[model samples]
Target: MSEPALNPLLVELRERIRLLEGGAARVRSALPFGVPKIDASLPGAGLAYGALHEVAGGGPGTIDGAAAALFAAGVAARTKGPIVWCMTRPDLFFPALAQAGLHPDRVYFVESDKEEDVLANAEEALAYGGLGAVVAELVRLPMVASRRLQLAAEKTGTMALVVRRWRRPTEASDYGQPTASTTRWRVSVLPSEELPVPCVGRPNWLLELMRVKAGECAEFIVGACDASGRIDLSTGPAHRQDQAGRSFVAG
Candidate 1:
């Protein structure tokens, strides 16, 4: 008895599947959001290392932009090496990012005159493997540009953060356009947590994971990443009270 020869295309596909399996293992071991709901929704229970992630602020201004920037910085803070922040705006408050656990000493800022230039610089940064993460603040990112960034990240295992900003609220709708990012998120400023002593407490954020390749879109209200860059599920009055109690205890 003789066996038939295997198809060359089939063999190639099998090899690719094997490689994907190995890649999946790496992604599973990457950094987590610390919030079970968010982590569980991502592929391999964590954010993919060699992928491009898009984040957009809910409105225009320092506060709205800070929400999105801090979210990206929090994730970057968790990764090893220095963070590269590429932005067209020079008004980035280093203190704010430091409060998110991304200190200025560990951050390298790249200022560009235009949003396109910022994105271009970001792609170059992502292609480099030494940096921990690359954050690009851009008002517009076309599909071709995003896909290029995605490919650059894929090659080097570097994480790319696209912080989409807009001059107008209507301009933000561009986020709905197609992109090659692994996950697309909208980070909105949520009402600050109330303390029992009649003052504000830890900041909160409304995170909408609008698109995830391996998981369905989901929304969560989470305690903003603390000084250590960790966020947990923060919803309901009970949760707020618990946070207040913990703050008092720590104080």
Candidate 2:
């Protein structure tokens, strides 16, 4: 009788070992973000290729929220091949995304009036291989739904991003609930660098890695995303001016 109980435990142990092996493979094939300060905190020195990541606006539909969208777009721009972007918002400015490196030419947009449909499209897109990435904007993501998305992405080596958006401020507060994402992020906008010519500088963002499943939590304040979505390392002068903000400043 005791032997039967031990058999079940042994089987579970084997399953856990298999899952660990798969995770190790993902870490080996991570996409390098290229910033030493931020990269050091991640398991693979970059975002894992076949994983699900969540990004949220700083305050839901505020300027910080828009910054979060642009940040996600920049990451997508780094990927090769076509991308499927699903959302309910008709206000996505094409020119802005072009500047962030996600060009309109390579992106296919899917708009739906229903929130559930958006997630459904994302799951299907993630299951299909050979695409750059899948980006979905939604307000709620149940644990089961997220788990399905994760499995789908894992099957095809695709990266999926859940861009959380809420119509009301109260709804935004609910994002703290648990999900099956490999990581969760909150992007906040900060004042631009004051230039010598008295004009606005390139975009700046406060990227908070709220939860990271396989590595230490960290924050990165990335300065501009080039046409190819490459971010240079932080400059020396900026670090000296603010010690209170323990953020990684990458250009």
Candidate 3:
């Protein structure tokens, strides 16, 4: 005897699953920095999508904080969709973000008085699945909350960036604690390049890869983000340092 006919609904479900699987592969792809040295240091040769990453200033000073925020803005500017920025403070410098290539119009701000609300808003935005990325400025991120954000990002193929901020030096110490983020970075302002004329040249930054999953920690001196959100390798006497002590200068 012949087997029972296949259910039409079941056939449709199978097709949908197949399509989703293909999309998932694309969704989990990496965003390359276009600078070989930096991209090579990251797993998959770039920052992975559908993951949670953390960025913080190297110190509690406003200069370091601004550098860190601009670094994140540059990353978000390169991605495709709208950005959801959740923050407790309303002091984001829009022109600075614009200079970093993240146009103000593409960003949607979720302002709240509490850090908890900011994280909650970020989680919801990540789950929505259509955003380019979700950025949350917080003083502290508990492991449990970070885990939730990571899972949401993985499920929807959205990137989550947590910018750690502190009102005081003591609160900045909280960043030392661990979280579920795939990578953690610290950006510190460095002296700008000396120009031939008596004017300020492009800014520079010391980018420290404090933590990475399945990758070695490294550091690089790089030019600050320009109008197109791209950072060039510093032209200074080139040197490299990794956790393993491997060193090479990329020409």
Candidate 4:
């Protein structure tokens, strides 16, 4: 005796149900940035659904590295959920983070002595879907490890930010770049533009947006942080003008 044949309409209905479930899963993924402009520049109008983002610093005193962390923190803050911060350095200043619009209460700091340990912990955190974001600071990140983290992020729908400190070799392999990430950004502190008023600092930054997946890049002068810990466009002048007495002489 043969088993009854499955109904074709029933099979089609089951496939549709599976597709809807997958769509819902994709929608559940977290975004890693709050800046509207930045998010617009990224694929999917945000970070990839589940992917690892790499932030590499030029040197020890590089403010770019700190900016990268703050960027992720800002994203987590906007998410309104707990953030897991894993780092090899123990000297993380909560106050500074607060100044960058990140609530210390929402952040969970984890310290690790080895880079590998930090990555491992970050992967674990990524596996836990409850986290808004996971940040790990390390000296080096292998391609294989990053791929694993990316996979885990997709499964859990958590955004992963990896801050890489300066190591012997500045260049990295293709895999070192988060293959799953919608975009990659390299931040650095350029000389702040001087304000017209004495003792007042100008809001300016040399921000470089490098897209790994799309292989595109762009540079822009962004406003600096203000009293409210937000980027204030009003703090800077609309355009540069010459003084009344200045001559329009050509060099």
Q: lDDT for each of the candidates?
A: 0.74, 0.73, 0.81, 0.58
Model 3 shows how many backbone clashes?
0
* Over 4 Å off, model 4: 1-26, 29-37, 58-64, 167-180, 193-203, 225-251
When superposed on Cα atoms, how far off is each prediction in RMSD?
11.9, 10.7, 9.8, 11.9
Compose the digit string of candidate 4's lDDT tens values, residues 130-229.
5567787766566688788888888867777776554344443332444445556655443455766777464344445666565456544455443234
Can you give the TM-score per candidate against the true fold? 0.80, 0.81, 0.83, 0.69
Instruction: Indicate the residue-level lDDT of 1 in model 2.
Output: 44
Ten residues in a row with the worst lDDT in model 4? Answer: 242-251
* Per-residue lDDT of model 3, residues 95-210, tens digit only: 99999999999888878888888887888777756667889998889999999999999988888999988877777878889999999998877667668799988887778888
Model 3 segments more than 4 A misplaced: 1-28, 60-64, 237-251
**Candidate 2: where is the Cα deviation over 4 Å?**
1-28, 59-64, 232-251
Clash totals for all candidate models: 0, 1, 0, 0
Candidate 1 runs further than 4 Å off: 1-29, 59-64, 235-251
TM-score of 1: 0.80
Lowest lDDT 10-residue stretch of candidate 1: 242-251
lDDT of 1 at 43: 88
Q: Which residue pairs show collisions in model 1?
A: none
In terms of TM-score, how similar is model 4 to the real structure?
0.69
In terms of lDDT, which candidate is strongest? 3
